[model samples]
Target chain A: MVLGGLIGLAGCALFPLLWMLSVSLMPPGAADTLPPPLLPQHPTLANYRVLFAQDGMGRYVFNSLLVASVTTLVSLGLNLGAGYAFAKLHFVGRERLFQLLVGALVLPAQVTMMPLFLLLKWMGLVNTYVGVMAPMLVTVFGIFIVRQYARSLPDELLEAARIDGAGEGWIFLRVVVPLIKPIMVTLAVFTFLASWNDFMWPLIILTGQEHYTLPVALAALSREHAQDTGTMMAGALVTTLPVLVLFLVLQRHYIQGLLLGSVKG
Target chain B: MRPQRLTGWLFAGPALAVMTVFFFIPVLGGLALSLTDFDPYALADWHNLRFVGLGNYLVLLERPAFWSALGNTLYFVVAGVPLTMGLALAAALLLNHRLARWQGAFRTALFAPVVTTVVAAAVVWRYLFNTRAGMINVALQAVGLQPVDWLGNPRWAMPTLILFAAWKNFGYDMVLFLAGLQAIDPFLYEAARLDGASAPRRFWHITLPMLAPTTLIVGLLTVAGYFQLFAEPYVITEGGPLQSTVSVLYLMYDDGFKWWHLGMASAIAFLLFALIYAVSFMLLRLARKRGAA
Candidate 1:
């Protein structure tokens, strides 16, 4: 029964993806015909070629990569620093401050989006990548994950470094970072995937076609070319394939990072 | 002061500064903006801004679109959350069964939708759900079932969105529940079996109790997350078929960006915040009534 249910349910979950693959390969106007083709009669690379060369998908891809990577690098540093401090450092109002920060999680991101946009406009960052990336550079959830994982790091390691005449900066760079590298990787994957897939921020902030990330670009394209199924499907495949491949390859870390911050954390 | 005591600030200062400037400030600023009569004109000229305390909220309450958005969001939450949870629980149980094979493959397939780009997925589904030439309609015709216009008809639009949401989300919850299920003591099940209890009874008394906390967390998260529905409809239907799919967040997005009514949009945002906050607390209260998480 589990096997039966498994195939049936998983089939339902994956059917659209398969359909997308099939239709994307179909000849132009094929999917629009009666009893739309289940499989492409003659598969071709024409749509993908058109997307990359003519439609300027290469630019969107580059923009997504640049934004996601930069966000990941910056967030990894900031979140790790703050999380390590909360976990291992002794400070006045430490617990209270951590609690205050954690409490901010309940306020959804949408609540601040409008004002954030206005703020960006004032700062002359509007329509720039910086504007799109600023709001998500560090998340409360990201900090929580680092803090939770870092709490388990043995105190003796930090204390030993301190006893050896190492300063706080040296201790963090030499000891804390290496010890918590796994969590850093998890956070990196999480941030990178999120930044890559994020639509609304880029859609709102990226005013010009030249600046649009893949997801935002695809959304705009879909609206304009709703009649062109093959072209849109090709666009969808390009938008989805990177993250899908990343998840497939590093699914262990991706799923682990998610579960660490969420279910048990 | 001890060096460690001061280093906390040194380490935490950057993150604190970023969050304060980007997140905390905007939250407070959104509240202030909600109290005013700011719009595109105000964006262009600061002098046009007027302090109209509660006026935006009042306007929102009077707007037919706002009520429709709230109703649509409520329908989604009431319908989508339960269906997603139900499917997740069922799938988790099936995968958790000792008799199940190739569980990992099944798990990955089910969870694939969660990571896929929403816009991309919506593109795929929009085609599959096309009014006349959709593959879904073709399949229905093959099966001798009537083909309904999934996204073009107001009655079916929201439901189709709900279905897409559940399909996309249930796997993440299923993974959570599977984790919860694994943590349950097998000895309890053994004891129940020895006592001649049926599988249904074991599930009712043991499985349900063991999963209460997981269920609570998942429920609260799902409810809160579902309230912010924007991407799917924005991508697939564009809140069309006469606006049946316009969620609260979608409405906020339209008002805020499309019309540049930051004041009204901020009010809608706060109202959404209040709603999700209340719903979260209520879910927690409901969970605690049966048992603690």
Candidate 2:
């Protein structure tokens, strides 16, 4: 009975994506009819073609890719370094600072948006990719996750590297990096997925249509093409597919990070 | 400073700098801005800004729209939290059961929604819940029932948002609960079974009690997340057929960005922060009380 229930719930969870994929493949006006077609009798990529060809979806895809990739690359380094330091290195007020940051998590990102926008404007980054990327460059949760994982790393190895005359940066590069490779992947997937899926910040910061990431662009497209079900579904598929695939491929690391950051931490 | 301390500072500097400059400072600055009448005029010229000293908060308190937004957000949290947690706990329980199969595939399928872009998912939901062309309506009509206007009706709009929120989020909590369940001693369950306890009794006596901390954490996170309801409403309903779905954050966005009432927007943000903090505090207290009892 429990197994049956699980299967049913799983079906409910998976159906939206299946329905989306099926409808996106439908010919124009095909889904507008009564008793919506479960499968396109003659599935076509026409909606996808329209999205890319006419709607400039390729540019938004590029924007999302560039932002998520760069943000991931940059954040992995920053979060790892800070996390390792918090775990191993001794600093004045380290505990207090970390606590402060963690406590600040309750303050929603929306609170920062208005002033962050002004600050970015002052820095001449308004409507730029940099503005969209700025707030995501370092995240408190990312740092917390890394710190939790990094604390589990043995101190003997780090001391051995130190006694062998390895500098902090060199130790981090040569000794620590290899040891924390699992977390690196986990954090990378976490950061990448987060940056890819982020909406409100990007929507607020990237006012220009050209700079809009996939979510922002998809949202804009949705508002305009609310009536165009097939094309909109195609847009939804395009925005979702990459992150979905990434999460599936890196499922282990992602779930590990989720558990680490929430339950165990 | 000692070399070790200096090294620690160096390692932590970049991330700290980014967090400080981009996030921490803005949060404080937002608070400061809330104290003044910061409007577009102030945006153009800082000279136009004047100290209002809780004036924005007072004004927001007086505004009916703000109250309705708060009501709408509270409605989402009150209704949505239980639904999300209940589904999450149910899924986690089922996944954790001995009879469960294809566990990995099931986990992946369930968690997929959590990873999808909110705007994209909202778009899919918007279409799925569309009045005439939507598959939901089509299915309803096929069943020989009257089709409901899911988004277009004020009464149904918030509930639709709640459903979307639950579907999007429940998996995250489910995963957390799975971890919690695994941590429970198998001996305890074996003992309970030997004591002639039925499955339901074992669950209530063992599982729910054991899972309380996880439940508290999940509950807090879900409530906090649900409070910040923006993207779904913005993407799906645009806050309405009649502004019935406007959340506190939505109001803040409207005030801060759309109207350029930065001061009022900042006030709204702080108010939301306080609300979340209070709710979390009360939840923790309640959990502590339960534990003590």
Per-residue accuracy of model 2 over B64-177 as CA lDDT, tens digit each: 999999999999999999999999999998898999898898998899899988898999999899898788888888899999999989999999999999999999999999
What DockQ results do all the predictions give, each relative to the true complex? 0.81, 0.79
After the best TM-score superposition of candidate 1, give how far the Cα of residue A185 lies from its true spot, in angstroms: 1.4
Pick the DockQ winner.
1
For candidate 2, give the lDDT of residue A226: 45
* lDDT of each residue in A92-152, candidate 2, tens digit only: 9999998898888778887888889899989999999888889989988888887887888
- For residues A129-217, what per-residue lDDT tens digits would candidate 1 score against the true structure? 89889988888888888998899999998788788989889999988899888888888889988999898878888888988999999
lDDT of 2 at A251: 94
DockQ, model 2, C-alpha based: 0.79
lDDT of 1 at B181: 98
Global lDDT of model 2: 0.90
Per-residue lDDT over B95-154 for candidate 1, one digit per residue giving the tens place of the 0 to 100 score = 999989998899999999999988899988888888898888888889999999899899
